[model samples]
Target: MAERGRDEESGKFTEEYPKEDFIKALKELESTGTTDIAESVGCDRRTAYLKLNILEEENKVESKKIGNVLLWELAVESV
Candidate 1:
């Protein structure tokens, strides 16, 4: 058990997402749409949409439709 715990602590079971990467992804998402955002972030389109929805619900971001595409952007001033 102790060996297993050490192995986990050694980064085998840890997944870290950098804040900078997340911010960059958010900016890219804002510039593009869900599909582009997913590609840029190295995630699936569905996951990208889900993340965008969560951010929107948290008032951290907003989305708008331009033509047939939906674009996301960070909310500078939260309500």
Candidate 2:
């Protein structure tokens, strides 16, 4: 079974998404859907969504809709 907490095999570290990682993910994807963010961060999709919501609430991340997909990226102003 997939162990709870951090999944080291997938590079999902417990230390919240660092600015560097966030930047890398954003630069690589330009704009990314939720699934892509989860894969990039090595976390489950739901976890990624939760973290994104938290970041959004903190003004650290922003989201935009492209068609029906919602893309996410770090809020440059917050950085």
- On lDDT, the candidate that comes out on top is 2
For candidate 2, the clash count comes to: 0
Per-structure clash totals for the candidates: 0, 0
What are the runs in model 1 whose C-alpha is more than 4 Å off?
1-22, 28-30
Cα RMSD, each candidate: 6.3, 5.9
Model 1 residue 15 CA deviation in Å: 7.1
Model 1, 1-79: lDDT tens digits are: 2233224456574322333444577765455688877777777788778777877787777889999898877778742
Off by over 4 Å in 2: 1-24
Q: Which ten residues in a row have the lowest lDDT in candidate 1?
A: 13-22
> Residue 24: error of model 1 in Å?
2.3
lDDT value for model 2 = 0.76
- State the lDDT of candidate 2 residue by residue for 1-79, as single tens digits: 6444676688675565554565577678877898998888777888778877777888878999999998997788854
Give the local distance difference test score of model 1: 0.67
Candidate 2, residue 6: the lDDT equals: 78
